[model samples]
Target: MYDQLVNLISTLGFPIAVSIYSLVSLSTKLDELIKSVQEVKEDISAVIKYQKEK
Candidate 1:
């Protein structure tokens, strides 16, 4: 019974750890994407201003 419990815990722990890691990585990637989009918006605004000046 003790061995079985240990095996079960080991199996479950790996997937739980993987899930937590995946969520953290996904959150970081989403933050990067948002920052990139904000940069693009700024670039577009600059282009619009330049066109208006011309």
Candidate 2:
């Protein structure tokens, strides 16, 4: 019974911890991607404006 409990704890606990870490890392990366996209949008807008002026 003790060994069974220990095994269960290790199996469930490690995966839960890893899942939480991965989610946090993914969220941070997604935020960075969004920021990069916004910057690209601004650059495109500037290019369009310059072309219109020309």
Models, CA RMSD each = 6.9, 7.0
Q: Worst ten-residue run, lDDT, model 1?
A: 1-10
TM-score of each: 0.68, 0.74
Tens-digit lDDT string for candidate 1 (1-54): 668646755878867756866898899999999999999999999999999999
Cα lDDT for residue 53, candidate 1: 100
**Weakest lDDT window of 10 consecutive positions for candidate 2:** 1-10
Tens digits of lDDT, candidate 2, 1-54: 668656756878967756766898999999999999999999999999999999
Clashes of 2: 0
Clash counts for the predictions, in order: 0, 0
Clashing residue pairs, candidate 2?
none
